[model samples]
Target: MSFINYATREIQLKIVYYGCGLCGKTTNLQVIHEMLADESKGKLTSLATNQDRTLFFDFMPLVAEAIKGFSTKFQMYTVPGQVMYNLTRRLVLKGVDGVVFTADSQWDKMEENVESFNNLIENLSLQGDSIDKVPYVIQYNKMDLPSVAPVNYLEFLLNNRGVRHPSIIASAKTGEGVLETLNLVTRLVLNNFIKTQTGRSPAEKKNLVLM
Candidate 1:
């Protein structure tokens, strides 16, 4: 979650990118690292398997000036997509402030996507977090591919599984929808952060943070 320091007037948050194997989770981070101004981002650390799939995680820290004397920073991460790395994935998600689920849109990976999504929920539970209560977003990746699952179908599955978080259509390779997804999640995470820190009622916090 976002950390708002009344003394320093700073807000720091962790945003995690999660998905199944080869679902473009790492690609999303690469795109951000490339697009952001060098001065705004920090060192990126990545651990990969022999085949180059994510092994541990990819982490990049970004800082942005906030309005009204408040500063905001985000430490972005990508969980290893392979199931063998489940332990690693679980480790990275601890204390995450926000989540972006990058689902592989390819039709053939439908089952894997569903299973991975379920894993996200299970893992979050292990961390003492409820998926319904977290600040999260879904990214349907590889939208440019012809064989990808239909948007409507994916939406239906997500809804049925109680994954009602906001979603974005994206092709990480081309950088489409990347910034929009980030902006949406950042705003939601910040709003949640402010609410928890100030101890505002849910409705009051929602209204104030959205403003």
Candidate 2:
């Protein structure tokens, strides 16, 4: 659920970046943090462990109309993708309005990607949210690297669900598809939020369009 502050006139939406270890989640955040305008973003913060790290920050992305005079704010997070950090990942997902599942495109990392994705669905269920209900997007990251799997194979592995999500292909290290991923998820979040807060649902997209 997004937090709405009438006094400050802001609606804060939380979006989490999830993926397998070293699958470019952190790299996505770093590139996005650097890309945002100073006036639009907050300080990037990181909590690190010997093997993994968690990152988060807030930014005002005025990509949508205000809700009852409240501006839109985004609080983004990246959980440690290693299996040992499952607890931390679930904790970060609490009250999340949107998700970005960043999959490593490398052939060798495919198994880890599937495991992390299932872990995601399990954690979401434990928290009373299902991927089918929650708005999310997929990012096939590290596309610039060699030995990457075909998009169709990766989709069959993860996004083959009855309700498929929008997916992007890119190299986060080079800032490709990063903003588009964020924008898509946030749009879904906003539409979902609007539908929840109001009685009507927003118009749906035409097809499984990749942003």
lDDT, candidates in the order shown: 0.86, 0.83
Steric clash pairs (candidate 1)? 1-97
TM per candidate: 0.90, 0.89
Worst 10 residues of 2 by lDDT: 55-64
RMSD of 2: 4.8
State, as a TM-score between 0 and 1, how close model 2 is to the true structure.
Answer: 0.89
Model 1 off-target regions past 4 Å?
Answer: 4-8, 161-163, 201-211
Poorly placed runs, candidate 2 (over 4 Å):
50-68, 204-211
lDDT (10s digit) by residue, model 2, range 1-211: 8888889777888889889988988888788888877776677667765554543322224323445577888887888887887887888899989999999999999999999999999999999999898999999999999999999999999898998889999899999999899778888888899888865565533232423
What does the lDDT read for residue 45 in candidate 1? 84
lDDT of 1 by residue, 1-211 (tens): 4566889887788999988999998888889889989988898888887788888899999888743587788999999888888888889999899999898888898889889989999999998998888888889999999998888998887646544678899999999989888889988887787667667755795677899
What is the Cα-based lDDT of residue 203 in candidate 1?
75
